[model samples]
Target: MKPSNGSTVSQQSALSTPSGPSSASASAPLAEDDPEPRPAVAALPRHVFSENEAEPEEGRTGDTPTLVFGVPASDEPGFREELLLPTYEALRRAFPDHRIEWREMSKFDLILAVVKREVDLYVVSSGFFAYLTHGAGSSWLATRKIPQASDPEHAVGGLVVARAADDRYATIADLRTARAAAASSQSFPSWTAVLGEIANVTSYPEHFLGKPRFTGDSGLSVVERVLRKETDVGFLRTCEYETLVARGLVHPQALKVVGERTSEALACRTSTELYPDLVLAARPDLSDSVRRRAAAAVFLIPESASGYAWTVANDFRSVRRLVARFGSAPSEHAEPSAALDRYKYALVISVLLLGGAILYSVSVSGVVARRTKELVAVIDEKTTLEQTARVSRERLSQLERAGIVSELSSMIAHELRQPVAGLVNYADGLALYLSGKQDPVVEEATREIARQAERVSSIVERVRAYAKGKSDVRQPSDLCVVAKRAFTTFRSGADLTGVRVSGEFLPEAPVSGDPLELELLVVNCLKNALHAAKSSPDGHGEIRIRVSDDASGEKWCLEVEDNGPRIDDAKFAELSHPVTSEKFEGLGLGLSISRVIAERHAARLLFRRAGERGLVVTLLIAKRPVEAEDASHGTGGMNGMDGTLAAPKAVPASHYGADPSRNVLSDE
Candidate 1:
């Protein structure tokens, strides 16, 4: 998942990067010499693995428990075909007392299946497994030990490549403006790994990579994109690249590896240090016995065309950290370190001078000799660049933290200005009234002074709470009362013409959470909606809030709808993430904080495009069961048997899984 800076030492390039057959065959890679690829999975009966032809008779008398194995569908049609549609006989022999069923799914669906207990185990890449572990609490049961030719260990690396003729891409620094072709966004080698490497060396990694085009689902697609010049650079897992070359699908000299690094212990060329390979992880509820039995059977699977055998899982902390670095939200105040900027200018000059010398030499020598010389030059330059990048990375980390603090200080000062000014004005008015002997005006000024003081106190409290990462004091309360109070507070601030704000609340909506926090969440959403409606092209808008039970009848839904400009898909995807906003004012932390509050309440916060005109944000909360004592107090905490509010359980990913097409946050 994460890329590495491995050392690249000079040698006969040919010796370091072998142009030989895969370990599987000397003739060709995965050709007719190998077994025919399994047929594609199609419509199947519910219990596809029920056939008992290969099941042992001794275990037939007992009740049969079914275990479902899930496999995420890959773009390479044949990659997962054999694994998913393995001969039923093999599964029967391996799991004789149990029925084995296979489920092919998309990534999102696969995660949901695990969360909802639809599948017992799933085979996934290390990067995706890390994502599940962080986002859904899934854990690994076992990992596959691929062939030495495939990985040499439980880990695998990735290769970043460019056309052999393109001389500009000599190092990671030279890849600044290059368009990249990657596999799926979730892919470790082709996407996450490449991103991690670039991010280490650059301040704005997104701009450096120039918006990569997701080619397809396989490593071969990356090669094809590079060869066709659809992308300036390409990324692939090391083994996949070598296998393609061995099959003659790609020419050995057609492409040059970027950041090419050689390790004596590594069997293949790589641009990144190896990370843990694919793994078989289990759902949270899978029994230890079943997990052990499954792991044992998978280890017994002899090496086949897939070039893998199951092995004990290695520590995947490195891969998890790698993903965390890339997925981390960018600091709004971040800038390139001064040291890096200085080095970059120096690097550019050196590259230009070296290129000029190489061009002159090429003119004297024949093309063949020039090509070999250029290869050596590139290798040497990349090694130097890597060292420079390492230094820059160290400086960048220190400077980044300082920049964020400075930016936050400036924002806090800006926020304090309004209330401070109001307080001064109130003080001046009171002084004038007292000097003029106007008692009535002095009384009014005193009240105004109290209000301004409270406003300042409130602002300071908010800043302190955010700094300390504190959650609100929670209790069982009525959702409708919180919504109404929040609506009233928001209405007091909204001074717009031709904008109608309306709310339809159900009679009773009991929820177990902080009332103040719930009110704040509602206020923030309403405030954001008002801003959107004000910016409507038509200059007229309607914002509506409705409280009712969701279609599922299990959760209470708070839907906020607005008639404003439709947010572009790209911006919509990042709504819940903190960033500087172009349309809304302040620190751009409102929606992000709202998401946090939603999480604390064990609710789902979703944003979706409402038809062709505006956006709709829905908050789905688990309905709280009301007790007899709850009705006694109009707005007090729930009095359950424990004399405290029931702790909220987080809604499973299954809640969002039902219809992702309608919920943008669900995809994230």
Candidate 2:
């Protein structure tokens, strides 16, 4: 609507009418007929212009601002009531603490108001910034509006008519020929826009329509009269048509398009097309920082009121297509016309980004799962191989012991050969003496030949015991009886060899093992002790073999300790090694095989130095009670006739050896 004449440019014109003396600066007062005291604050910053400073934006937060919004070049608001809140509500919702100022100004003047700080900020279409700064040299520090996320906009356009009655105006072509009810000459919908914009003049004669019907009001009101059937064909925005139609007040079948205008900012509908409708500009002189921030805040307002976003300092190239598409023909929006259109680019980028995120997660999972499987397999195989290796080592130990014993048997046989040869010579002498006559010495000679044969036989038996590993032939025998039997049987040469041999008779410590094997082990040690003593001329050491029960409540141990010599740990260990003697005169097999037999009977052979001098060889043999004591008397052999420990008749000393060192070292 036109402002009151007293408040418009008429006041400026009348200011020049006063003929009083005037200063060269034209600073003269206007005619004072309309007198109203202007408030002192009116000349101050807050009162210079009014919108934001006059009311609270919302929560009344910071300084109250004066907000002046640029008017759309067109008169219609396109968004439906469902989406668009009134401007008052939009400002309240955005700045809850501060009041917002509102104004209706020309789009270009709105830009100047903001530049002069006469307004806080304004919202506009995309290319408005380009217009202000194109050659204005202020674009360097400006911020442009472009959304980072998707947002939708709402906008509409208008068509004009001379009247609303379709009966008189069957179509726009018919009305154009009659008369027109156009907007002001400078209005986009009015006369000047016919040639397009306020500068161009074309299309109608001044008297072509009845003396121009002087409506002298806003463009929207002129269109309203036609809808009321007061005029013929005229122009307005499509948003205006939809609003009246939505309020159940109008119908589209009542009119037809006889003319159209074009723009790069508006979308086309089957009903009308025109310039894109939006706030098109803001002032350029405000600090670039504040201008940019306030522009963004306006866009942050609900799209229901202002549409998608504000154009801060954006150039025009981006929106030209949208701008070019707008016109005054009513039509539906067209389908996509190119791959690089906004919607297409958005869809392609979205798919690529989503696919990349999914592939990244899958790759990480695949690597972790594969490594777990590989490590698990390695651990399982290592455990299985270790068990197999342990079993293999035990079996190898047993084989080594058996090999040494077989080799030792042949050496022992050679040791006994000489005694048997001497027995033959002695038997022949006794036979010759008895055959010629019964001499008194003849009986004595026969007894000596028989003793020689017994000595040789005992040596042979001990060697054979080791050959069999001594595990099969077992009997219940007292450790003491076993010791004594070996003593009497091989005790014949003990004194002659200066090897005193004796025993501690712990008769109750009975054991169950091969009788011969027990004798071989005990006698072998005793014989070794005696020989060691005999080798010393100053030696008076007695080989005292002891058969005793260990104090450990459940065991029987045969301890044979001698003072013959002090043996070292190395010699003691070597004595039990399988092939140690294969390279020496001592076969070393005796102790090793004895230990094997001991293990079979759940026993152990413990050898160590004893009494600071001699060796202690103990047979920690496991025992069982003897049941058939009547025949053997717990000795290992049959004996009873004289209540004495009767040794079997033995071979004699006629088997004396020249190389004593080559003797088998057997004392029984």
Candidate 3:
């Protein structure tokens, strides 16, 4: 917009005005003929800005003139609103006939929006205003006047802070190895001013402190890094530091000011030269009445208004001087069309040079390309033949191993059967004789002999089935029955002298698997648990076998826990691999074979530490179909003495293990 003298005033021209006196800096004297000052503090309705807020309805109609003010660039979304809400309220009251609207956006976005005429006014940093006026141009309407308590003059300084306990750095020169953090690269006091001070000492300023970390856009965020020891030092605006301490956001004694710059105008400790605080800018074409009213309304916002007040716009030459010295502003001299025109000749020469080289290279390599393709095809064919030969060799090896296992199984079955049958016959005859004698000692001996015979016969049957290549017949069986049977046999017959064995069977734990195989799995786990417990530091130890559903209720767990020395986490897998046992006199194949059986039943066998002193082995299987329903009614089927049971239709079963108090099954 042109002035009354018919000359257009650029943004630079506006900022070039003589510096206003510091006392009148809070409220620049507007036209002498404006309205008298109203009370600075006025109460008004508050509106919170969020994604859910309804758009202001006051300016929708064409009758009331609407003015939109853009928020400044700050890390915090609420920084501008918290400080400017009171000022906005005052403007609404002063211009009751008009509508006032606030638009929230980032610093860079706000600059672009105002320059493009998308927004009418903006609260921006002095450095930003200077950079804008240097190129795209800006119109200065008013500037904020923070109190001398918060800010001494129109300018604010940069504060460099380090931990109070850190004694390595007393000044900026001592920051050679220190890591630096700041609000952002765009912040003047946090970044540009500090850079200006370092540039005066050395040309390569990075040599002084390496690269600085832009921690975040908020002053508080950068300060937090220093206090948390995440960074060695922090830089932020002097006013920001004072304000944080005043508001109890941070404690003053926690941080020490380094390389403190003394300024009578500055009421707080700082490190770098002070630059102007945030300034208010407006579009050059804004109507005179709106501009005047806005300028007046801002000045009326009182000190009790939470530090909200405006002074005459200060000459922002200090900001320009710093920016020009440090070369911090983005390039503004390039025009795409002019740049293209200037580089066209060089572009033509480069394209011509590249085309000639490509033509020569293609002419020389045509035959070589064809030969290379032929070589690659021959190599691929050879690779394919090698892979096929390797597969054939592996198949033949597998067949040979299968044949050996079959022959071995048949021989074992044939050799073990005759002795097993003879042992059973002899035990039966002994039992018959002992029954007539009715001697308790002879009767017990005969019973043990019969049990051993039965065990031999069971092994013979299992070997015969496998020798004939017949898979074990799997049937829906109650696992609780299988677990109890195995526990009863192991506790009665195994030589566990000092070690105590215990079992808790949850009834109706149904699973689909071979009952004999499941029994073998349980027996091996129990025997191992007994051995481990006996070898533990206590010498006399306890083993507990538990059968229950998992937390998910979809899986069942058969867990055997023993009070044994815990295995380290790194060697748990080694226990499952076949290795000769140091304690037992055979290869350690019991647990490994049990794992195979578990896989056959679509289950997993896992070993883990139980509490701090023992190991627990768990076999996880799919839950039975009716398990959940039975649990709700407080019933898990009854215990059938025989191991054959599909579903339990009765009450829960009893515990099955040898009593520790009894001296039966001694090691001797």
Candidate 4:
């Protein structure tokens, strides 16, 4: 076996058991000498084998398998060797025909030997054995029972020690700034266990104990360093100090245990929780029969002088928890530095991916905002075009309707002109016959008949000129005179049993329009009002004609109001066009013709709701100045009329015969 630092591997033959009478004395001479004297053995258990022990049933043969036992070399001379001597002697006695070899190596190398299948069985720390069981599929065989331990499973723990003379360091807190020493970083009880305990107290265990110095492969060196003041505190396996004191190597009062714990089943002074001690485990590939035989041989070995025996340990959970708390278990595959390098690469890639995602999101947001803005502008343009198209359609329809009405009017006037002339001639002859008779009522009736016949002739001429598209002769006209005359005619012609008519007129409200056309406009308004009022559900209705000038004296308004069922906005809008009439005998041209006449005079025809149950029709025309009467006389008359300007005929107010209480006619 070669020696490296304090670790060495020694291969020994199990058949080379000592022939001496005492096993302790026999095992003492097997240890290799060192510069420092080794501690004397305390006591040795009785040897497990006798000279007449049973041999294996199968005799020694060339095909006999050799059992390789792996053991970790310790820094302390002869410590592990002497402890395992009896088991070697017992195995040699049990399998006399088979060969047994002892192979010693460092703890790390021994674990590798087991993993590589080079060693059939091995001795390992409880914590490392748990790691092997999980990571390497190693199987448990037995656990070493510690001397004076109440429970074999609770035999191992770590110790924190300070110089007894140093009063400044007594508890674990006192060692926070103290330099720490240990047997080896790989030693579980001396190093890992203590670190795990300190980890429980502080998040940074490295800062808690400062930095630990690993002396050698033995806890004895750790104790020596503490005595020399090279380290303020020393970490050791449980009972290591007591074992040294028993060997008379160190004084009992030389050092003190920091934060020592007392346990009912544990006799050792420990600074951490107890776990199972050394375990004997078999490689998974080993034969079951061979494994059972090896375990039986381990159980046969008597307890050592230092109180070491083997028994099955059902639980190693405490050891497993300790290893897990310290982060990772010992592995032969990778080092810590290599794993850290992989982590660095992963972090850089993650950051790059995150930055790219943010940039992508911002770009997408900008694109969506621009798209939304463009869509809104398109929508607004579409709405404006739609409105323009609708207005154009309405104007085209009105022109078509007007053209049709014009043709119809021309035909009707042509057909009626001769008949109207014949009626006028007949009325004239009758008036001549009745003039001298002087029956007052008959005379007045005859005059009315002539007047009406002449009115019909004038209306036909106006319609014929409109059909010919000839401009009418505009003249200075009083809207009040036109309104009063139209209202008087409407009252006389229409049934008025339950109907009332009234007029409110601005006496000289003036506007520039053809007098005949103005009269036609007022007459159409009164006709519509009377029809609306008579349609009322109560069969009682009122009509009022109002002519007034605006405050600015710029426009004259002729308003016809009636207490009738009102029309909704949609129905009223239809009134401006030649829509189907609501009345049974109506031709639906009254309002439309009125609108055309008002437009000819550059005026507006409007209709509105009056209160909750009425309709009001208004004609707004530009006011005429007094001087415009002479200005109009200078212009010639209409196309078919003579070149003379006919003065507006005057009608007596008494001819209206309006009832003072009901049919009121006011000249305001």
Candidate 5:
């Protein structure tokens, strides 16, 4: 009787088959009431071992060995059970005392079980068997025989299938850009075998099929997708199309095999070189006697019982080669080992060269460090030389300014003498007229007028003396009073038509300077502002004069601003020093002299372009303490001379239109 569960069968019934009544036949007599006495059931036969065939060690121990057979879980539904049933039944008949157990697991788990010796034997694809033989030390017992194939070893391969109606893919190469489907990426016959064939024809086998979709576990789905136009091509196991057609699961005319190869030994249409079929392999640790018996039992299976037979295929060289080419071979490490051995000398030479490069880098770094230090010393020397040159330039500039001042002094003195004489004549006439009238207010005003005329003469004489290198004393004076006086004087002399002039003055803004020179500087700035304002496009202009002290009381400012045509920043920057005047009918001496007087008072002259239009000229000076003026009265002033100012430094010759060759100062 066949095993009910297909996993285990009792040895008693297996041994008693055909020799005695079955249990059903014997039990039927027990249920009968008719008294025709049944002849006694034939006694079950006992087998005896020959002298050369010793009893199994398990039989001696009275414990049956359960032979576990493992199959891949990825096999099609019912394929595992059907494939192994014949072998299971054959093993039961051959060893009546042994037990048989069947197991289904993934290919990876099945390999692990075999390697761990958890399963005594396993049946897996030839590709997996090749791995087991080399990696897990499994011994091949038999290779499955294709019933119609003349050669068992050349029985299996992959098929590239496409819809018969689809003329787009007639061959494997034509399917490169076509949408392709496969059973699984891990399926050997469905994917790897096809890939191997493509690898033979092209260097890039992975991309030959373009990106194929993997339908789960069975190639039938891949065929269905191809027929439904879901995919243009499908990869299937060899004979899978024919098997589906025979089973009525597929219409034979619906799909065609691509790149089909014909072999007298193989009956199926295959696109790849035929390799060995599924293998029954024994674990390395399985007993030799049991392994031999199992192999014999597998060989004894009648082909009629399972429609397939097991045969010993000594040549799995083709399968092994495919596994190696696909990089799934257990001996994959051998390739890298051989490469390393071949290049060992070159590797050593490269190491030596790298070491030399590192040493050279270290030496070069040392040289760079030494060179950097030398460069730093050279830079320091350059800086020191630049400083010396700057000092010499300043001294030379001072001499040039003095020479220019000396050259202009006579002309300046001549111009001022006439103004001074006119003032004196007017003052005398006013005094004479007042003497006759004897009005007290008029007499005081005439005396004040004469004093003012005397002060003008004194100022012109002092300017000429200063040009000749005489030191005039500086005294604490209210800058606000000076600026107010300059503004009043400018307003009196200049045309006031179409121009508005205003002043913002502090009550007291004290600074140490020659008061006459300070007033002259303010007057010059006011004159320039008035000129700029009058040059406005509209002919109507405004000028504002401001005299203020900082909150610290240590500095004071005189600012004169005008609304006129906007001066470019470059031109305004040039105004910081006295440059040639851009105006018509004007000498640039006005600003040059103003700058000199400002320098003598230790003040800075700054020119800035006002927003939208015009220029703002500012004189920034350090404020002098009130006590210093009293101290100065007891002693000499800045030049240690009473009532005289210190001689000014020479200005750059560039400012005075002197010979450029003699100007040593850089514009910077």
Candidate 6:
């Protein structure tokens, strides 16, 4: 599910940034409602959608392989600057439960970076992609050129220009003598599709005005130079052009629109026929699954209106056609390498095959004979390791049993006695004061004793299952009952100190997880969510939890999403890979242990990402029936597939759902 439009960043803020400094005065002030720009996201977590519901539009009838992408820098100045960044950011923000990473490098370096077994994806300009696939690029990608993720034929190219002017160069012919610049001559829609064609008509100055001038230094530089009149023109895709115009870099009338092209109505304009821009290309040798995932990511981008939506998914044929026609644009890849590769395989093969036949056979036989002994050693070692694992499992099981028992006992004491103790202390102290001091002081003390007694009772009531160390529990429970119970159980004195638990749930939606454990999970998730949100740039951020299922079968996903700073891909990977931080407190055990519990129920654990901000942690539990056990709410009449189960619809107010807003906070 998507967050509220405000929390997610309104299109207005994104569309209205002033490019030049002076425009601030003439430009409207920041929204009155928004004294300071709202933090990217709110601090509260909203689960308007429950974990046991289907995602808004993800109809998962089948499975797709995972795909990887390799890109250069993060967002940059202009046209070419952040093309992949937002796409990457949006992907992370929207689909927080997938695997994606950026291998950071200049787009120009992708020519050498993409090999049969190298990166699974390369997000370069369409023109740059054309150069690689011209020949063996097929060997680099596959037998033929293909669209990165989408179907190529459906993809369109874009044209970036200074906004159109009433009195301006009317056509490419008119601008034939104009000095136009671009982020790169090799940029997809910019130079390759737009200005490069213009170059054929324009007379080349011996220098960029006087020296070798190129806008490819950065996308924004081109726009900047054009605005400064250093270059007469600049090019960008419609989306990018909109971004610049929004940012106030160039006015709509600052430059002339020499051309405009479109693939659909109400679509962003382009200078040339639209061709695939950022593609999810596979390393010539990626597995089928990887390729599929890569494609899905691209296709799904545009699903949510506010999601990082792509216009279309393209196929290989049309993409190849464009690559063939455009050929290679001017690029820096032609430069010679400073380092040389050495080949030692030939020498080794010659020595092994020719000179050492007889001698090598004798040596090989001896080595093989010795290896038979080594195999024995390896098998023995493996057996020992297995044995150790068994012993460790036993010990760990004992420890878990002990921990649970101990924790339960502590909870009981803590719940039943703490408030009682407080009451006793207050009463005793007051009795002494009343006898020896005054009536008013005794009355005040008596009130405190009553308050303490009530507080203790509240704890005892919520922790019934925890105190008993049993899974048994009865329920006529509604969503509010469960939430309030959990909240009271883990009550913290300060609202800000603990997590703000705020998502809504459908009470009528039947769910099967153990109510006690489920409550525990929610509380734990709330605790973590609050901590994580507070640690983020959007101090008080929003966490969205949603549940739904479609063609992929029933799934219950709890997403603790935050647009806080994103963890580095490397660190994120480590956490996901069953990593252990020996002395790490709070975060380490929580995620690792929670993951174990989720998997036991045939659920998945995932961490979502944002652009260098916040983390979205999700527990995706399949709704299929469990073969081993029945669901907890057996009478809810939920149908089961395998051992997992799903109700006809979420229990009213008990089944959870959520979406977030910008600055403003709402309970429902």
* Local distance difference test, each candidate: 0.64, 0.45, 0.66, 0.70, 0.68, 0.48
Total clashes, candidate 4? Answer: 2
| Per-candidate total of colliding backbone pairs | 0, 64, 6, 2, 6, 88
Instruction: Tell me each candidate's RMSD, in Å, in order.
Output: 39.0, 27.0, 22.3, 23.0, 15.8, 39.6
Off by over 4 Å in 6: 1-68, 72-101, 115-118, 138-168, 195-212, 261-266, 293-302, 310-312, 315-322, 329-668
lDDT of 5 by residue, 1-668 (tens): 33422333222322222312344322221111223322222212222211122334432443656677776653232233345667866776766666566666666566556655678878878887775565546778888876657788788889998777677876677767678898766566777788888877678887776668987646656765666677788888887766555434454566778888888877778898887788898887878988899899888876644347788776878777767666352233233443355458989999999999999999999999999999999999999999889767755675586567666775687698788778879988878866877699988887767656766676667767776678454666667656655665566687767888766655456678877788788888878887888889888888887777756667897788899898776677557554456768665667877888888888988887788898888889998876785675442333211334322122223332222453221110
Per-model TM values vs. the true structure = 0.39, 0.30, 0.40, 0.43, 0.58, 0.33
Cα error of candidate 3 at position 357, Å: 19
- Best-to-worst lDDT order: 4, 5, 3, 1, 6, 2
147-212 per-residue lDDT for model 6 (tens digits):
221333434454645434324555555554466676654556655556344544555412222232
Off by over 4 Å in 3: 1-47, 51-65, 73-83, 93-98, 106-117, 149-154, 247-251, 285-289, 303-307, 326-668
What is candidate 3's lDDT per residue for 464-545, written digit by digit as tens? Answer: 7666656553456777767876876677777777777666655357776767788889998888887778778878788888
RMSD of 1: 39.0
Q: Compared with the true structure, what per-residue lDDT tens digits does model 1 show for residues 1-668?
A: 11011111121211122235453322332222223321112211011122122332343443557677777655332334334344222454566667665566766466456555577777777876776576555667667555544443435767898888888897877888788887766577667777777777898776787778875446666676777677899888766776666545466777888997766545778787677777788876677787677666666666557555556666878778877666321222333342245358778888999999999887767777878899989999999999788657744653464457546855785677577667757776766657667677666767657555655545455554646666454456667656665676676677647787766767557877766667779988888888888888898878888788899998989988889898887688667554544654566667766887899889999988999988998999887766633653443334231223322222221332222232211111
Report how far residue 142 has shifted in candidate 5, in Å.
Answer: 0.7
- Model 4, runs deviating above 4 Å: 1-362, 432-445, 468-471, 492-501, 510-512, 527-543, 562-592, 602-617, 622-624, 627-650, 657-668
Candidate of highest lDDT: 4
Number of clashes in model 2? 64
Worst 10 residues of 3 by lDDT: 37-46
